[model samples]
Each structure stands twice: as C-alpha cells, then as structure tokens.
Target: MSKVILITGASRGFGKIWAEAFLKRGDRVVATGRNIEALQGLSDQFGDQVLPVQLDVNDRQACVEAVNRAKEHFGRIDVLINNAGYGLFGAVEETSEQEARSQMETNFFGVLWVTQAVLPIMRAQKAGHIIQVSSYLGLIAAPVLGIYNASKFAVEGLTETLALEVKAFGINVSLVEPNGYATDWSGESAFQAKPMEIYGPVKDAFQKAVSVPGFFGQPAATAEAIIKLVDAPHPPLRLLLGSFAYPSVRKVYEERLASFEEWKAVSEAAHGSN
Candidate 1:
C-alpha cells in the first residue's frame, strides 16, 4: 500500500534512509529537517512523492503547521516518525539545567508536540502509526549519557501510554529502541558537556567505549527494521532495532527483576497487610 509518511531529522542518518526507502517503494514522504538545502536532493530525486520541509521540532507551532502542510499536500498522513532528537553526552551533575532542559525539549516535548498534532487527523482517518526513534538508553542508563538517557526514558513512557490511549482510535504507537549505530549521532549530531575534574575518568571510559572499533552497527539495517514494523498489520509497542538491543535491554530488565524480588517481602510488608 502506498502511504503518506512524515519523518523529522530527514536530512541525514536513519531518517534520510527511511525517506529514500519509502519513496522508492512508492510512498509519499514528507521529509523535514532544520536544513532545507540538505533535503533538496530528496525532492529532486523523488519529485512530487517527496516534500522536503524545513522544520524545527522544538517549535510546537511549527510542528502543528508542518502537519497541516503535509495533510494538505498528501491528504492524510499514514505514519509519523519522530526522529529529530540528538544525544547529550554528560554525567547528571556535569549537565547544567539549561542543557538538560534543551535535551528534553527536543527529545521528549518535541515528540509530544508532533504526536498531538497528528492525533486528530489519525482519529478522523481511523488509522495511522507513530514511530518514535528512541535509543536503547531509553531502556537502560549509562554512566555519562545521563541527560540523553533521561530524555529517551521520558519518550518511552510517553509512547507506551500513548499506544494504550490511541489504540481504540486505530492508531498504533511504536518505540524504535536502537543500540549504537554508525551515524553522525556520536560526532557532530551529539552535544558534549563542559568537563568536570570529578567526572574525567568516567567520561574517558564512556568515550573509549564509544570509540571501540565495530561497536556501532549500521543505520540502514535499523531503517529496514522500522519499515518491517510499519508494514505489520499490528505493529509492536516497542521494536528493538539493533542486534545488541535485545540482550542489552534484557539484562537491564533481569537486573531490575532481581532487585524487585530481593525487596518483595519488604515491599509487601509496607502495605501493612491491608
């Protein structure tokens, strides 16, 4: 089926791959980014099938207007990919409030704005899918990527609740939890915090881990997995996109389960046998 798809952060990385894939498959794509020129190639290649819109997801009004423009041009959007966020690499204490808030604005609130903008249209159409391009950090926290983890965790919570709330309206919400992928995410797309003496070693370890050869996977595979999820008759609420995601997230959940089990008696006793 030829569907109308809107993707934020489509200038590069996974978003660009998704846009091209969808266009090649004959779907109408509304590719949005901060740089209009970066997306001109898509428009030139796909012609009317691609609408390259310059967008800043942090602006809620722009998000709403972008949705309106897409709906006007393509009639109705069948899918929306919230993929506009970037990484904030810092320890919790090293990250200033302003930086943390900016991270949340882009990764969490921006997703909320986009979803809110699309809900009415999907409800009226009686069908749609919202895919959040979250990270594995959403499910498991790391030492230095505290701010990024928190933002993605918020996204996870919002997306899960949204899935339950909108299912009755025939809208499916899915979180694409990808592990480290070979993208600009760790370089130019990422934000590094001001170094603190206390966090130097921790930061070094984090950087070392990231710089390890072959640690990151490919973005094309992640995009392909997302396409499979979207094509499903009933897509999952959480789709782990990378090979490492399942085991990594599983370990986190298992550790959490152990902790809860160890505290089960105390937890139950706190209820006072009521």
Candidate 2:
C-alpha cells in the first residue's frame, strides 16, 4: 500500500537510505535535514516522489510547521520517521551541563516536539505509525560516549512509554536501535573531542573502533528494516537495526537485572523501621 512518509534528517546516512527506500516503493516521501545541498541532491535523484525540506528539528516551532507542511502535501500522514539525531561524545565529567543540554535538545526534546506536533493529526485519523531512530547506546552505556548514551536512553524511555500511550489512538510507536555502520554519521565524532589527560590511556581503543569500516552500523540495512516495519501487519514496539545492537542490549539488560538481584538485600532495608 502506497503511503505518505515524512523522514527527518533525510539528507544522509540512514535518513538518506530511508528516503530512497520509500520512494522506490512508490510512496511519497518528505525528506528533511539541515544540509540544503544534500537535500537538493536527494530531490534531484528521486524526482517528485521525494520532497526535500531543510529543517532544524531542535526548533520546536519549525518542527511543528514541518508537520503542518507534510499535512498539506499528502492530505494526511501515514508514517513519521523521527530520525534526526547527532552523536555528542565525551566522558560524563568532561561533558559540561551545556553539552548535555544540547544533546537532550537534539536527541530527546526534538523527538518530543515532532511527536507532539503529529499527535492531533494521527489521533483524528485514527491510523498512523511513528518510527524513532535511536541507537544501541539508547539501551546500553559506554565509558566515553556518556552524553550520546544518555540522549539515546532518553529516546528509548520516551518511545517505550509512547507506544503504550498511543496504542488506544491507533498509533503505533517503534524505537529503532541501530548499532554501527559506515556513514558520516560519525561526523565530528570521528576526530574532534575534548581530550583529557586522564582518558589518554583508552583513547586509542575508542579511536580504533571508530576507524573500522562497518563498525558504525549499516545505513541501508537499517533503513530496509524500517521500511518493512512500517509495512508490517503488526509491527513490534522496537526493532534493533544492526547485528550488534541486540546482543549488546541483551548483555546490558542481563547485567542490570543481575545487579538488581545482587542488591536486593540493600533494597529490602528501605522497608525496615530501623
């Protein structure tokens, strides 16, 4: 079934692949991103099936306006892919409050703004799907990528709750947790960092991981899964986009569960009168 799809951050990486996938399927695509040249290139390649819109999702008003524009274009929106995100890498202490806030603004708050903008329309229509492209970090945490991990964790929490909240509205929310693939998705994270003398020891390991191809995550495969999920008769609440994400998530969950059980004695003290 052909439908209208709006994909945020559609100029490159996973977003770019998603736009092409939807267009290839004869679905109308409204692709949005911060890069005008990239957006123009996408439009040129995909022709009229892809509508390129350069947008900054962090701007709540602009995000809302973008949704309205989508409504005008397709008469109604069937799928919304909130894929705009960035990787802000830094150790917890190395990252200042401002850095954390910016990460939250882009990864979590921006998604919230977009979802809020679409609620009324989807609720009225009584049929819609929302796909949020998060990260494996959303389900797990690493030593250095603290800020990025926090943002993704927030995205996970929001999407999980939202899936239940909108179930009654006939709107399905799915969280996409992608591991790593070769894309400019790394961007500045590929080089720049506020290096610390203390972290100098393990820097090589992180840098090595960054340099490996296919270590980042595969954009095309991730996009392919999203296309399938959107078309699924009954899509799951979450989809792990890369081969590594699921195992990493399972390990983290298991570890967390074990810690909870190991600390049950301390937790039991909470109810004591002492």
* Top lDDT model: 1
The residue pairs in collision within model 1 are none
Residue 244 in candidate 1 has what lDDT?
Answer: 77
**Backbone clash numbers for all candidates listed:** 0, 5
Tens digits of lDDT, candidate 2, 136-216 = 888887767888888888889989999989999999899888887777766742323476788866667778866766566
In model 1, the worst 10-residue window by lDDT is: 218-227
True lDDT of residue 274, candidate 1: 46
Alpha carbon deviation, residue 165, candidate 2 (Å): 1.1
RMSD of 1: 1.1
TM-score of each: 0.97, 0.92
Q: lDDT at 4 for candidate 1? A: 97
